[model samples]
Target chain A: MKGLAELGEFGLIDHIRARFPQPVAPELGIGDDAALLSPSAGRQVVVSTDLLAEGVHFDPGFGPARLLGRKSLAVNLSDLASMGAIPRWFFLSLAIPAGFSLETIEGFLDGLAEQAAEHNCILAGGDTCGSKGGLTISVTIMGEQRPELILKRSGAQPGDDVWVSGSLGDSALGLKLLMEGVRLGGAHDPLLLRQLDPTPRCELGLKLAEAGLVNAMIDISDGLLADLGHICEQSVCGAEILLGQLPLSPALYTCSSKQPVFPWPLVISGGEDYELCFTAPRCNREAIQKISKTAGIPLTVVGKVTNSRQVQAILPDGTNFQPSASGYTHF
Target chain B: MKGLAELGEFGLIDHIRARFPQPVAPELGIGDDAALLSPSAGRQVVVSTDLLAEGVHFDPGFGPARLLGRKSLAVNLSDLASMGAIPRWFFLSLAIPAGFSLETIEGFLDGLAEQAAEHNCILAGGDTCGSKGGLTISVTIMGEQRPELILKRSGAQPGDDVWVSGSLGDSALGLKLLMEGVRLGGAHDPLLLRQLDPTPRCELGLKLAEAGLVNAMIDISDGLLADLGHICEQSVCGAEILLGQLPLSPALYTCSSKQPVFPWPLVISGGEDYELCFTAPRCNREAIQKISKTAGIPLTVVGKVTNSRQVQAILPDGTNFQPSASGYTHF
Candidate 1:
């Protein structure tokens, strides 16, 4: 945030780049007049963008540039994954506070470099400006998916199996603990870790796309119920989920300390998980299992698609429950 | 600035988009799941980004978002023009102030859409966030060029004819007058307008690029002297410029109150002209004229490349003119 003159622009870039290894892509990653990328053949590129503001997105003390860079890219990557696409390139534009230092700027860039490399994405271009305000990170991601194999929110249909990948609620809990002043290395350490470094199911997404096992897809970034409702809305259909069948995690269960917990909020309202939530036709069940085995990740079936335009949940006692709210509202 | 909640997220987008028609390129502009664009052929994309902070880049009241959008894209497009590239897509990340209304956002978007549509470029994707402090904008532009024809800042040589398109200092003058409350009409009006919407010389840029008329190129967003210093540093050479050769408009002359006045500040230290300043072989004078005629833009010879790495200026009276320290300083 200090005037760019204080740190010198070139030096600032080098500092930010120190935290990240060169991306896995064959060409350049950070420093360049331009970036070179190899796109998959016969694929329509999928592009998405998201911006994170200082106060609205994270606590400045806890959400360092490293995490911010990762989360920024992670959220966009999740969007591409929802379409069953392979991420390739990214553009980052950041605004730092006037009092910010070169070292802090570097931290942010380092974070971006690290996460971009992890996903095999090239950091092609970006801009720097001295803002009179808080820190903001804007990321645009490019992904490519085979023309016909791409998944859409509206592809869900009656009898399609609704499945989710990986653990959830940990991020939400982590955020909660942070908000509640819970110390690290406490009983909820794992949950805290999940919140800090939430991984996206990019590999699973690509596999599901390649094997044609997904009908409708979305990322569990906005929580289960909210994200699930997106597919329902787009497909103009209802859904039925058995509460007991929900993929509740161990940390979530342990948070209750042996007491039976409703877990509705954890599974339904916990967001920022970056996991994949998708629906597949019955014919692709074996393919889904094969992916689960090959990727060494569990693919849990949570429910099924329906013909009606309502979302109904059956509790452990066999009583139907409806979502209290759909998803997070940024505004 | 008004709180973001006054307009809501979707309402903000609509307000911004209301100013113009959809962006020129199809597939993506605004209001969609994602923006889409096609990259130009055979070229590794040339991309660059710059972040503008409220207090650093502009005062909110002095420049509108439309101008900001144009300036943001123009700056990146300026980078692409420097590389002899044609821009195609852009991604914008904006952090709106907590006290702003959706109408304020629309003012910015209106400018962005107008400029983008004029250039046949599309708003591929970007992020919008609520800031705790002031406004910030980060723009990333993507462009394409033939692999072999791309120009660089380091290609200037002795004996090259230094050239620039359009008159310099108009935009800067417009800014000064507007900020200082000095006003004029006719050609002067355009000069002030130029400050808010300086043309990027993109068409001339493409022509000069394809015709190979220039050795090196850069856009005059930063003052001519400062920007010229960059080319000199990169190319490891010097330059000799003649003040009389500078293209100053009639309005600039009238600024001295109907008397002949040396407006070198407008010519040399002035920035945001968005014109192409380049070096070409002296032998290409005819080609330059041909391009000038074809592109319907003036291409004038202003000076020559020099042997040493110092920038020397010859004033109208044959006196040496040293450049002042003031120019566009981002930090």
Candidate 2:
């Protein structure tokens, strides 16, 4: 395959346009100056944008280009999922270095296409250009949901039960292993996959939103405590978390038993989990439990909202728990 | 002022969110995982995304940070203008290098706010992160328009008169002077300002769309001939332009007389002019002229659409004209 420079910008655009055909009717997709979409009647639009730089977000040599592509879209989809919106379309802008092979670009797009297809999202419009440095990918995803059903971080009230979907800390631990150059062999290694290709809990979020069970919701991208602090700050409340109730995956436990060092703090402060964390009134606990069973995702009660206006964690032995680092800092 | 590293990502975000306050209702602005917007009744949505890398798009040392900020949003707004949509909201994702001063970022945002305020567009949501290399800014702009009022490049027909708004070639000429190390005095130099801060033709586009006077419309970001070729290709037609009809700015002529280097080819092949080019039926020429007079812009007929599928130019001497270069190539 020819390199990106050899393919030229127009050829690369044509290749991408061919991969994602335009949708029929009311919306005009790619190949135009801009995309035209008819917003669904009675629904509000949800939008989010994210940037993933080469060295800052991911190391190209550490993971497959396909996984990077999946992760790029997955991260933005998680934002929409957190808002309980149904993914519909996305715009991708990429800055590719001169040295990038066309195969690498294809692999990345293939992975992105697979994820978009899973969510029935369409490629609307985008821009591509040469980069003097490493590859930079920026994505803007759009979704739609009923206005009244929209959940916001400011909706949490004191005395509400705090809950989390799925396990935590696996992705942070996976990143640690990868940074230390520990390859667990197969591509399907559970821990490595958790870091490389985290799933957006769209189904669970939709189910919870439709059931009207959650008062407030957020995706756990910046670890548990930091993100919970965001909710507490906005809702003008506090929370008390039981450290023992934090869900740790079997893969994390197995790795910890084999290694001398245990990554305990990662459960609360590590990032890139992409799981849903929400609060609900205790009266709706049974309904949430039924939703968890139907959605096939584990729902764990980790804490309760409080009036103290501070986020504090309690250890299993009844001592105050503190982490060395709060979460990932961009700067 | 301190560098970006000293401000930290969250502090920078807070700084930005403070500048652009959220709208009163019907739309949720920044400080959230995703932004929620209610689309206007009976209006379709329009979207466009663009990326600008530091080295590829601009040289920071040669221009003011405020102009770069203005240009960043201006280019995306031009896309919405080309589609005849009313600008509403935009998402910005920036990758800022560690050494960038806080003043530079604030300057850029100030210029962006100026342009956004002029168009009545709001900053909905965005992501800011650290960059290993130079600054990379990506923007996704959204707008709304009635389905029937939207303009596209695929609507031109044979016998249509091709028209362009405002003058051309001045920006390209100005860029040539700057590249040659010719700083033409103050910040208000007309040529330099034309190149550094081009305006989007939103008013003219809206008037044409509202009057239903144009068969096709496109923004001249990729030069006159190349962008005209886009309309021809999509509309399945050809164009024959008259060289004498090309509108050259007085600044270009003055610079040419002083430099003794005539850049005539730039009139048809240069990029980044951000002017509107369209085609209308011969019968509606009077109406278009009336629109031009009412909108306070110069609308000139530069060519005519043909049944054949080739874009050709005729010199004033009644001979065929061929440009030295077609247009700007991204890669």
Candidate 3:
């Protein structure tokens, strides 16, 4: 394989464009000075950006370039989902090491295009540069929504029902399994799969927003306690979590059974699930449940908003529980 | 005095927000799930992202974090300037080391705010993470322009006159001076200032686009020859450069006079100038000249579009000259 330096910057960009042709051509995308985006009339754009640095975010020994690229965009898309916005366009800025192989770069971009196609998101424009440090992938995603349909964290009120879509702690367990050198044969391992590629709940979010079933929402990138805390802080309320009501996959339960203390820390404080934690009026529980079934996503009632100002966890036996680890933090 | 990790993610974000408050507040900037942008009706949004990696893009000894932050945003703004777009909102993703001080981060954010206020660009959203490598700043800027007035690289005609705003090669000379450990005392040094903070010709670009004088446009970041090559390639045309007519800053000319040979390569192929290189019909020359004066930017006629499909540079003695180097490339 030819080294990256041989192709130079423009040549590498041409190679990338050839490998990842846009399914839906942007008004102005690659090969131009800047990308052009025309928003629908009366639509408000939702924008978010995330940066993933090597060593800090992932271990190269476990994460391949292709999966890394897919996960990077997936994380940003998750932010859009949290806001109840439809994923539309994205921009990528890559800082690749000098000696990195062109083949690896191709694989990364191919994965990005694959993910973009699946979500109908267009890769608008990006910049690539050589890095003296480890590889860094920065992605900015732009989503669109009607102003009235936008979900925010400050909308939750006391007496609202707290719900989370999908199971929690799976991704955190997946990371642990990877660290322990436990490979259950490629993507067949549910834990490893969750860690490497968690799907963003874009459809479910949009449905909830359109139906007005949810008042406040956020994606669970951090652990349940910390993320729920954000809603609590913004909504000016508290929350109470019933430990027995937490939605956990059987695989995670089985993995926890083998541990000495049943891994409650991972269950409560795990990060990167990319599931929605939302609050809605308690009176609309039945409607919310119906919508959950229609969306084919299990909506678990984990807790409820309270007048108290602290988040509390209650064990199965009615004993108070407090988590040891809060959530993931960059700083 | 606290390290970044000590402040935690949310705390650090709060600190950053306090220091870099947006003067022109975005509709829903920062906090919450994502930033909100409401584009004016009938306008197209222009988007561009650029990444600057330490060691590869800049040397730590010469590139301070404050200047680097300003330059990072400036580079992305240049892309918008080339498209004749009005700077609107920006997103920044930073990868900093764990032990990085809050003071240094403050300085960087301060510099960013300074530049954003000058252009009326709002800092809408950003992500910060720990890095194992040197600091990296990735910026994505969104601009707005009416569809008809948008400039593109593929609109040059066969008989269009080529013009470059401001002098070329000053940035290259600045880099040379830095490498030689030459400093003329702070911002007073024209060469140093050019290298550290080259101005993007936004006003001139908007004027040309609105007046419908320029047929094609691009920013000269990757040197005159290579950037001009992009326009020629896109427009499916050729260009002829009269080397004698090339605009050179007095500082650059003085620096070249002391060299073994005139530094034509720097003037023709050096990168990071951030000046506008454009093409217009011969009939619009007077209008362009008048607008350039009003904008207070010198518009130099250095070349013209030709029927041939190659970019040719002619020497003062009427001989063809091919550049030994064609610009900087990451690879």
Candidate 4:
């Protein structure tokens, strides 16, 4: 395949434009100075932006280009999901190093296309240029939802049940395994996939928001405790999560049994799960469960919101559990 | 001042969030999973994104941190200006390398805030992280315009008059001088300012679009002929610009007189002018001049749209002129 220099900037843009055909009005997509988007009447626009820098966010040699692209969009989609907005449009800014292969770009686009198609989001507008550093991908995603139905981190009240969707700790463990160069063929592949490819839990988030079941919500990108701390701090309340109640995937359980330590810290504070961690009033438990079942994702109530202004964790045997670090910080 | 590592990532974000207070509803700004924006009724949202990479886009040693920040937003705002959109909100994503000083970041934000206030734009959301490479800034600016009043590059007609706001080649000459380490203290400061801190022709663009005086509009980030070339290609027509009629700033003329070769190539193909190049019908000339007087920016008619499908330049003696290159390409 031809390299990026051979393709040139405009040729690269045309190639990318061809991959993601404009799904909206021809005037509203790529090629314009700016994208013109008409939001559905009365719906508010929701926007979230994230950056993935090489050597900091990802290791180029470890993950496939396709999965890296998928994860890039997935992380931003997770932010929208937490806001309970329907994924609509995204702008991508890529800084690629010189001599990068067009085949790798195509592979990246292939994976990005898959996610965009599944979420029904369009590639609205973006900027691409050569980078003197490693690949840097920045995405700004926009979605729409009725203002009254949107979720925020500041809505939780005392006595609300703290809940989490899917499972936790799998992704962090997966990263650990990958770093150690441990490749367990079949059984542990799920763990590795959890790190490489995360599901954003959009459907479940939409359902919860639509049902008016969630009091506050945030995606578990910075781990359960750290993200929950955000909701607690903003909501002006505290949370106490039970260690025994923390949901662990079957794959995590099977892998942890063979390890020397139980890996509870990874389960507690490890990052990049992309699962929804939210709070709801006690009366909506049955309703939330029904919605989760409908969405085919597990919902576990692991804690309760308290009047105190701190996050506390209880061990299974009734002792207090303290993590060395709360979560990941870029700096 | 503390370095980035001393301040920590969250601390740095808090510092940034404090600088640009949300001018809209409190729920619409930073500190959420995503920013929530309510667009004006019946208006379409216009979005543009641009990336300024270190080394490739800017020389950190040459320009001040404040101007670097200002230029980052100005370039994106130029895209919005070309579309006749009123600036509203912007998202910034910065990848800062380790050991960077907090003072530099604060200085950068100071200049960015100045531009944001001038344009009446708010910082709605963004992401910040540690970078292993040079500092990278990606900005996505969103604006709004009435659907019918928005301008585009595809509207120039065969009989239209080609116009440009402000002068050309000043920024290009400034860059050339800076590269050669030529510093003219007082007389040439305007040229340097033109390159380091470009003023987006937003007001002129809005007036032109609102008055329906322009058929096609684009910001001249990619030089005169190159950007006019965009208008020609997109409008499916050709253009012939008068070389003698090309707008040259007084600073450019003063500097060019001292140089051996006339800088016509830079005038034609230099990038980052941030002027407005547009096409209008012959009938709108009087009205456009009136708007230009009211806006207090020079509006010059330098050419005409033709049925041919190429961009051409004519010398003072009516000879065809050729440019060494069309414009800047990142790759």
Judged by DockQ, which candidate is best? 4
For B1-331, candidate 1 gives per-residue lDDT tens digits of 5556766665566655565455454344564435545454455556667777776766666655667667767777777776777787777777776567666666677778877888776666666767787777777777777666777667899989888888888888788777786454444677777876667777888888888777888787777776776778778999988988988777676774554656677678778787888898989999799989988898889899999888788998899897665365445
Q: Model 1 segments beyond 4 Å from truth?
A: A1-5, A14-41, A63-65, A257-263, A318-324, B1-7, B10-43, B63-66, B69-72, B181-188, B256-266, B317-320, B324-326
Give the clashing pairs for model 4: none
Model 2, A68-149: lDDT tens per residue?
9999999999998898899999999999887788899999999998898888888898999988888999999999999888
Over B1-331, each residue of candidate 2 has an lDDT whose tens digit, in order, gives: 7777777888888888888757668678887789999879999999999999988888786577898889999999999889899999998899988777889999899988889888898999899998898899999999999999999999999999999989998888778777877664754278777788889998888888999888999999888989999999999999999978888887777767776645667778888889999999999999999999999989999989999999998988888888877887666
TM-score per prediction, in order, is 0.87, 0.98, 0.97, 0.98
User: What are the candidates' individual DockQ scores?
Assistant: 0.49, 0.83, 0.84, 0.87
- lDDT winner among the candidates? 4
Q: By the TM-score metric, which is better: model 3 or model 4? A: 4
TM-score of the second chain of model 4 compared to its true counterpart: 0.97
Cα lDDT tens digits, model 1, A1-331, are: 5545666555566655555455554444565444544455455667777877777777767655567666777788788777778887877777766567666666666666677878887666565555566777777788777667777777898999999888777888888888888756678878876776677778888888888778888888778777777789878888888778877678877884565756577667768888888898988888798899999878889889999887777888999876665555555
Once fitted onto the true fold, the runs of candidate 2 whose alpha carbons sit more than 4 angstroms away are A258-261, B184-188, B258-261
Comparison by lDDT, 1 against 3, better one: 3
Model 3 score (lDDT) = 0.87
Which docking band does candidate 4 fall into?
high
Candidate 4 error regions (>4 Å): A183-186, B183-186
